[model samples]
Target: MSSMTAPHPIDDQWDRFRSTLADASQLLLCLDFDGTLAPIVEEPDEASPTPENEAALASLVSASAVSTAIVSGRALADVRDRIDGPKTYAGNHGLELSRHGLVAVHPVARKRTSRLEAVCTALETVLEPVPNCRIENKRLTGTVHVRSVPRRLRPVVRRHTHAVVDRFGNDALEVSTGKRIFEIGPSIPWGKGNAVALIAADLPSETVPIYIGDDVTDESAFRIVEPDGIGIRVGGDEPSAASCRVESPTEVATVLDWLGSVGVDLLESDTSELSSVDTSSFE
Candidate 1:
């Protein structure tokens, strides 16, 4: 996990990353939905991609050499509805996936749906007193969002939430933490890493995979594409498996913009060096 930050237009580290993208025959561009594409809002339902990011993503998706996918913690249908361009999506932390117009849910996760419902039901009862604590039951998985909860009572929310989930036992469900949320899902080994690899499997062997995300849950994905592919962590100086780090979703949009413009040039036989791209404006 070599962490580097950009303080100028385009640093040497970015140039190297661009070089890799320039030489690739094909690219599988995968991104996490919430913090990666859209701003993480207090109300989860309100989160959507910024106009610039959305348009840049549309450009990448329209490219002949790029295949785009959104891998998210949101439910498959939910993320698909929120993001309209990408035909491939992995939701519920990869418990459900839609690719090539076919939808698949992990068999174990499907079977555990009833148990998850029961857990959520119990959680709602115990968490009712916590202000602004949202319990989202996404069928295959669930989340207890405490981002808007009063800071002083957040511990109470976590304690009560875990107590209810503990009653269900580890075999039936598991808990994972993110920025300010606790995700409760079917107890399984599958995650974003497995989901990314599964999606990459269908691509050409030479296709370079680029995954950008901003969550602890996304670490699995960062590790999955290491050594060869690129893993970019967004908005943190925290130690990560990601090879590169960017400050915000705004910078992410710049990266996407560069890919759409410069990438097209390189692919179409234009070998001219990319002019210095001013990233300082984004900061």
Candidate 2:
């Protein structure tokens, strides 16, 4: 019998990684809010990053050579309120973005706002009797959270969620699953990948994009960063498009610390060779 070994931790690759950051003209550090920065909590409102991670992020944000961004399923305002310092934010799975002083919402996503609201209302009515089922109405997207629902009633929750999605018409809205949640957003071509690409367009030519996320939805971003950047997945045993994996939010903090150190070193030295990493294997 043959067995597969566990994926190597992202920290193990530091020797091969620091040079990429040191050499880049700019560094775009994109992160997912909930699982990647803060520990996943049963109540969404309770999620917050640890003090150490918060300080690390603040340091990175303050660094002149690095630009920090948060890409999340939460609303743009919500994520902005959660994370103290990031140069840019992409929220509602990239349906909305806010950077510098400009904010943009997808025209197509805006068109489905009424539809999303109606679905949330319908889901609220249908899931009322099902204990622990909560409906969150984000402006660009809505999510039905079943994390606290009894396991036996999970199937019922899924059934009702599907019925609501069907009632709204799949062409107008689509359903996507996340950890213990079902998200309903406009069925458009936009996603995290498109958001990252858009953000990258404004960056310098040699900007190294580093994306860290922990969800099925994050796979799109992983693909985007594979070509010339680093894609890190947090807390999963399954095969993912991400080139590296960190075990949990604690490990994610460690990575953030490493990045903070790299940023500080690069700023202090300001004379490292501008070398590029071979990204062919990631492709």
Candidate 3:
């Protein structure tokens, strides 16, 4: 599907979102960790949510009717440890998921771990000469970070990284790019959308899903949530499946602040100003 030509700013539609929030019985809030909850850093290991954002997340998590999940490209444990409030975490673009005392790994991706590791090993050797490149092997997936590489040499990194993955991947893995990184994971239909849909399935049928993210990888979830739920894109004006947009992670924190505060009031309130809006449309 095509993205909106000019998505409305999130604040402009905050009233509409509140209307939906009031109509729904539960809220499923899905967020992308890096670049959404936290600022994008050159060193991924140092990334963490701002205190304001983390506190807001904790506020949302404290509500029984609100279920929060962190979906990211990092490993499941990696993203899970980065944030403390979300009860659910989906990582490696949904190849691995943990929620409700249950953990699931895509069977195909799990089986390809050896091949993924091999490809990462090859990528490390091939990309070594490239300055500021980082290769990560996340068991079920791999990534080549070129965010800090010299702009002139980025194409070289892409070419070399692709060649290595193609040569050793042997049809077992596929490559996708987002923000300045190459994601090498199992060749499957699974993605952030599928993971989100799966997680939503476990929530109450009346739950309204709201996904906020800032990268290309998060687009899949945007597509999934746009039909009946809310899809908010962070930091870009580019065409996106997301219907709402914000300026940056700082703004995202503001949205969370409103969500955590206004959300509690709406969910707990007995009346809604827009109650006449067709609730059937949400189904």
Residue 207 displacement in candidate 2 (angstroms): 0.7
> Worst lDDT window (10 residues) for model 3?
268-277
Candidate 2 local lDDT, residue 151: 93
Error of 2 at 52 (Å): 1.2
| Strongest candidate by TM-score | 3
State the displacement of the C-alpha of residue 244, model 1, in Å, after optimal TM-score superposition.
Answer: 0.9
Ranked by TM-score, the better of candidates 1 and 3 is 3
Candidate 3 local lDDT, 121-216, one digit each (tens): 988888899999999999998889999999999999889877987898888788898898988988888899999998888766667899999988
RMSD of each: 7.7, 5.9, 5.1
Give the lDDT of residue 168 in candidate 3: 87
- Leading candidate by lDDT: 3
For model 3, the stretches where C-alpha displacement exceeds 4 angstroms are 1-4, 268-283
101-195 per-residue lDDT for model 2 (tens digits): 78999998998898889899999899999998899999689999999999999889998888888987457988888889998888887899789
lDDT string for model 1 (174-234, tens) is 8888999999987779999998998888765667888999998888888888758888888
The per-model lDDT (C-alpha) reads 0.83, 0.83, 0.86
Clashes of each: 0, 0, 0
For model 3, the local distance difference test gives: 0.86
